[model samples]
Target: MASQDVVYTSTENHAGFKIDVVQYQPTKRPIEDRFSVSTKSSNRLLLGVYDGHGGSHTAEHISNILPTALLSHPPEKHAQIFRETDHTMIRAFTRDHSLLRPKSKSSDWVHHAQVVRAGCTALILDIDVNTLIASYANAGDCRAVFYPPVDAEGHLRQTEDLNAKTPSEQQRLAQEHPGEDLVVVSGRLFGRLMSTRGFGDACYKLPHGTIGNWQHRRYIDALSAVKESGKIPMNSQYHAMFHTYRTPPYLTAAPEIGTMQLQKDSFVIMATDGLWDCVSSNDAVQIVRGGLEQEVDNLAEHLLHSVRATRAPGDDVTILLLHIIHT
Candidate 1:
């Protein structure tokens, strides 16, 4: 198994403004999270963060492909881009599985299964300079928190009031599919994963039937072999112990997309669930509020430290802070 890098940091200039990103992976899980920031036509800014589980292939693939899809697709409707990306991911993973099935006896097939069964939760932010609105797409629990400047007295508002009004928190899910609401089986997401929607995890996303059931078993066996060989330490039994008991397509890649108007002297923080697992939304805002007053580079590090202080074993953590300087 590939070992994770301890920390990663970078800054991007989005339409002449800066967006800083930071990631910390204290565990040895291959740093299964990925992020991207891109621009188009000098006005549109696209930013994304992907948190992967089971494996990193899905997150890495989306981080590399989703931005290009957005840029090349017609701008008439941006949400459609996320749908297109989801469809493409399904097609790509299906094709890869088909090509490997014929050679299932080979070690290559096991490795391919490891990669194909990987899942990734995603959060995307699209900003158009002309409108001063930030469009967001979320699949799974990765979150985006926007913090307006504190009052002249130098105190930030309570977490509930700030988060209650953020676009990410207010967007309601329109009923469309059965699995849209999170389902828990034995405290695990769908009883196997932590996310209800994401890319990859084809074994879980497939319709419940003979073929899907067979694939699930195959994945479990492969994962066990990898773990026993010391290739990875991730617990495969939790996922193997449960099966989809409800309708077909127990998990989805469909993204929840919405928009938020930007305001000056405010900051938007996007991060993987790792951060939220320990820090509350209000606490996170307070931390960033202090960071903005001091330095941006310390924001990510500070958040990670705070999460660690909670004494909970942390997950792979990634933070993207966008200070709305001119938006």
Candidate 2:
């Protein structure tokens, strides 16, 4: 049974399987999403949608290590791994420099895992009591959509966090740079290689160096701290200084790093760029609603079928569907 992002009068039945089909590649990878159901008081249900760019290396890296990364945290860590992983991911690009470069020793693909230059985007949803919080983090074009369920009447209702972007975000952009487009590109799935924010992408080659906020006050503060610490002499050779100090790598799709109070009528959908690029948030929500109302079987397959029907000619599609049954 699937529950929408609404507080329904009756109990909602919710259970789902994440699905994927990677096109344009010689090999089909197992889905990157990792879903687990736990009996803990929080009734932990972890669902992650990872979309990778350059190649599947980024996806594979997250698929293999994210579980371990989560394990590294004793639940008391409260997403500390998120930050550590942030550093761990960038440590490569910083240490090695050049995300577009074919990394060997430091690449997650070579030494530890078989990862490549690919960078990944992720959205994780955790279901705790009286709240179904979803973390929409990505360095690429993956996305998460929340849909609230309605009754036989076909009415619709959902959580307030459903809107995209925000006025504050616009204000923040204005504060940062006046002329720069607030929503650079459509922010649509297939447009920008790296979303406004994400995890593994390196500094993009642009006429201006404003890919995102990667080179902002945080960087200045970091540079100031490093300089003050006297790690290297101010007049030292540029090469030596660069070798000593470097900025952390960031995913194209960085999570808002948020906490939301989720109730029933909560349905969460996360998928890689392939799916989100071809499909819009509203379109995805509609498909789930339609599937549940009509056949009510193989919702994942139904989603894939719809995505295939609408997907672009050259797209690598992967999707992970989740329904938040109980808060």
Candidate 3:
């Protein structure tokens, strides 16, 4: 059975704004998503959502580090910040000798390897209260949608979902790895990861032979242990990926950045793919519009309820709604 949902609202930032956040985990596996909201100054508000796969380590780490990193840098440097953070995590994982030791016990090595392999999609929104500018940086499939003034008929803006499934993303991958038709198979990178850009996932980004050598040594050690104990051998999921791996750095952490000027009757919705899997961008705006028309108590919770009533999310769901009240 699914665990209890996490729901809350915050109005602690600058005046004329209310933020509602909700998270729902529908599986037994650890919730692999993380989110944050912080006030950088009287003028700036930062919000982030990370959707993790393979494990939650990368998402958790990014959640803790990214907000401060973004607050310290200018908008132009945000993309570089993301790449640097990802590289930092990769370096830390690769240099940890305690995890890479061939003679180490299986559980220890496996846990470390899993941490290295984990990756997460990121969506960050930086709102400037003074300028009314909302800047967003995104990698992977996490999304943000802007709802225009109620009088403006049928106008909505949203971020693109950057995954191997998108044609433009596929073309970019094809260009990067020429003649490799298998670079994307069935909407997944190397027929495995769906996200084409994000943090961590060292197995996809590391130098080609790095993971291969580690896997070979680890497999040998596992075989030896199995022979001695007559136990089933531990298998690494990336073995097949290593066979087809050719290029280094197949995935990236560089985010696509965008900006919008907020106005009265406007709001923004930021969510992980779990919500998008069941609700389209247009539908999401409509749901929020209906909620506002009815003067719902909590917009985010109301939206989440609508989603659950329509179709249950297969993965962890996180939603953030920012209600813009012009002063």
| Top lDDT model | 3
lDDT tens digits, residue span 235-313, model 3: 4344565567777678999999988888866889999999999999888889999999999877887888898887998
Better of 1 and 2 by TM-score: 1
In Å, residue 102's CA in model 2 sits off its true spot by 19
RMSD of each: 6.3, 11.7, 4.9
- Residue-by-residue lDDT tens digits, candidate 2, 1-327: 112211111122334323222222213433333222222334454556565554455566666666555543444343566556655655543333333555446433232222323345555555443345443333334565556643576444322221123344334434544454423235321123333343443322111124433333232222232232324422343332222122222122334545444455455665555565566677777888787779465555567566656554244555555654433
Clashing pairs in 1: none
- Give the runs in model 3 whose Cα sits over 4 Å from its true position: 1-13, 97-115, 149-153, 210-238
lDDT of each: 0.64, 0.43, 0.78
- Candidate 2 lands at a TM-score of 0.55
Order the candidate numbers by TM-score, best to worst.
3, 1, 2
TM-score of each: 0.74, 0.55, 0.85
Q: On a 0 to 100 scale, what is the lDDT of residue 248 in model 2?
A: 26
Query: What lDDT does candidate 1 reach at residue 234?
Result: 31
Clashes of each: 0, 31, 0
